[model samples]
Target: MRRAVATVLASTLLFAAAGCGGDDSGSATDGGPDKFKVGAIPIVDVAPLHLGIAKGFFSEQGMEIEVVNTTGGAAAVPGVVSGDFTFAFGNVTSLIVAKSQNLPLKAVAEGNSSTGQDGKDFGGVVVPKDSPITSAKDLAGKQVAVNNLKNIGDTTVRASVRKAGGDPAGVKFVEMPFPDMPAAIANHRVDAAWIVEPFFTTAKNQGAKVIASNFVDAAPDLTVAVYFTSEKVLKEKADLVKRFTAAIEKSLQYATDHPDEARAVLSKYTKIDAGVAEKMTLPAWPQKVNTASVQTIADQMQADGLIKDKFDVAQVLP
Candidate 1:
């Protein structure tokens, strides 16, 4: 949320590229099914969204969805703000940071949650099989890779180090995509990598060791990320937002009720192997976002120097 970054974002919004998708402008008003451009990362956490689309949950609501893949939620913030994306999936830390910057963002639905189990949650830190790092404390002064910096990956990873009696500030964090992390670890490019499934499972399948369950360390049953929209969209397209939210709730429930199908659906949009998909741990998909857990993330961000102000989680929750 630096001043220069804010300035750049504002400018970027004006010229944001309209990615693949049906137009919401004409189709929405022409009485045809409302088309929505959604931004999402290609990860296991987004399985419910794809599963729902396949099940016609969105079509049932008289909507057609076009999902635009981004590296992370933070990258899609501008797309949502600019109306290029009707809604986007993002991590809680990224959304809160956007709110702290006075961005008009509101989380419309819960995206994903941690399993709240030590060493068993969907997101954690992994190391090469023969690496000397044995615990969170060992990450001190060592380079750790994360999908995004100043976001959930590093925030929760620092929490894990702190909880394990390590100097959280002593760990060096490097930015790298989730998919590239396993290879980085294998080649000793980094000491450890904070990752989520199927990468977490994929790394373990390659004999990697799980050192810390960072998301679980962050908070109990933490709401890791959420589906959000810009405030402008909510106010301007109230009915569209309402229908999309309803479809999302049903989709979350469906994913929860049928976990196997949810795992099976990864093949449609992701390159995750079927065996890894089946073995990977799935996150909780509750209909409601965990406000308390989100508050915890906000608090962690401030403690970690990622944010300055005390973020009001209510400002972002719909």
Candidate 2:
């Protein structure tokens, strides 16, 4: 018998969503039998959620959470909109795009944000160890791989490339999942790959090197992801939402205070390597969702042509 190495698994936003029916008889003041379904990617950004579960944060608040793993936010969004998921984890860019298209979604909490500290690894464009690409400028006339198009990757990478004295318009972006990025870069299938943690650590350990920290450069202290639900869910399940938010805030605080324990929870939930989980750069787990941070992403989407009109960020924040 041979043992095999394990692999890790990883949502989206949509418009015109339905309500995920909840327990109307549930107590709001005390923790009740209110249950909520959540769609999420099994990534480090969601470490706090797992940490909360392990610490019984949600249970203590009288909420039971069912977290479903999806490919990314794009896929997760549909679940959230159709009432299949009461809430979901998604990048702000996708949420903004959905909102721009008239989706009745509201961000209930902040999920993760990039670190502003220098020399700290958050996310970046990674190239083969010996690849000639040195800076974002070297990426001109080359192909790049991003997890999604017209979202965070496209917006930030292009901005960073231009800031590096490169012609971003000259670069082409292809969608590639983060898990496959290391092999893709090694095979020369993609000139470079835009990736985030755990995968970012994996890429580096597998002979890939960072070309530029594009995300932080293009957008610093950005609220990359959020916890969101549809308008119907918000209106119908206000009590559940309130309790969930309070529980999540406690979870975030726990994750912030106990980084190692949070990483351990991430590994347990996602089957990610415990060692890798320990080394990965964790996103900042904010206790509250900052409207200004989210607004920055919306503004960038508009400038990048991902959104047609500028909308008030407050409208989507609960």
Candidate 3:
């Protein structure tokens, strides 16, 4: 597995380096092809998208691709719906909420799916190693920090608490960006934090003891992330969407086969240290959209009140 991963990574890195000087205009393809502008969040889940670009996957499909980094999942929806991006990497929960409000978005492809391989999917509800709150049930009345209110962090933690036979509503959830989660916990602003990488790795390195992981308590095989395109783009550029999906899939395969190479490429784009990137638990890349997997997400969203009206899972899954 390691050897195969390295070979794929090496090939992708060479491909990416060669494509660097290609056309940047959204108008011209290297081989007189269609132009596209793809957007993604600056999170690890979208690393395969970066890998695709760097590995010349888009170029290989005769596409002139430009990538934009957005603020968060919530912001990505508007950009895609308004045609600011041909496609955007968004969270499944956020997409469901947008669809509930009649956003003109269609999920065109699967990005990365979370797994328990290295603790990558859901974050650990962590407390200082020396703290007395050693379990999920012990967190009652304690303050917990999350990246955002009513987002994945909160939802996952609530589910985890219930799974542990604790009251989901017992803990108070405080909202804070990932960068500040550690400090907030350290300063006693919150008793614990439900955090994702690289904060998950960071918190543990700082002697934080994990009380629970989201995947362990929440539903496994959840569709945490996906690639979404607007109705406008879908109608006018279905071919481009297909090409993009192919390139993305190739990139994902390469990343899965070559973790070290993937980490190196990610470091080039994200500036995260090689060591830290390698140490972090990366998500698994699914080859195709699984309706069953996505249905689980929709079900969770409906239960969380993120989606108001009933949605047919088949209509949403690409």
Name the candidate that leads on TM-score.
1
Tens digit of per-residue lDDT, candidate 3, span 5-78 = 33334533533453421332234534487776677766677777887787888888987667787755666665
> Which sequence of candidate numbers ranks them by TM-score, best first?
1, 2, 3
Could you tell which candidate, 1 or 2, scores higher by TM-score?
1
Superposed model 2: Cα runs more than 4 Å off: 1-32
Candidate ordering by lDDT (highest first): 1, 2, 3
Give the range where candidate 2 is weakest over 10 consecutive residues by summed lDDT.
1-10
User: TM-scores, in order shown?
Assistant: 0.94, 0.88, 0.83
What's the distance in Å from true for residue 107, model 3? 1.1
lDDT of 1 at 281: 95
| Clashing residue pairs found in predicted model 2 | 11-72, 11-73, 11-74, 11-76, 12-73, 12-74, 12-76, 12-77
lDDT of 1 by residue, 1-318 (tens): 464266447725542554322364314676878877899999989999999999999999999999999889778777776677879999988888777777778999999899889988887999999999999989999999998777889899999999999998888999899999888888889999999988999889888899999998989899998999877677777887888899999999999999999999999988889899889999999999889988998998998778887887998887
**What is the per-residue lDDT of model 2 for residues 145-187, given as tens digits with 9 covering 90 to 100?**
9886767787788877878888887888888888888789878
Q: Against the true structure, candidate 2 has what lDDT?
A: 0.75
Candidate 2 to truth, TM:
0.88
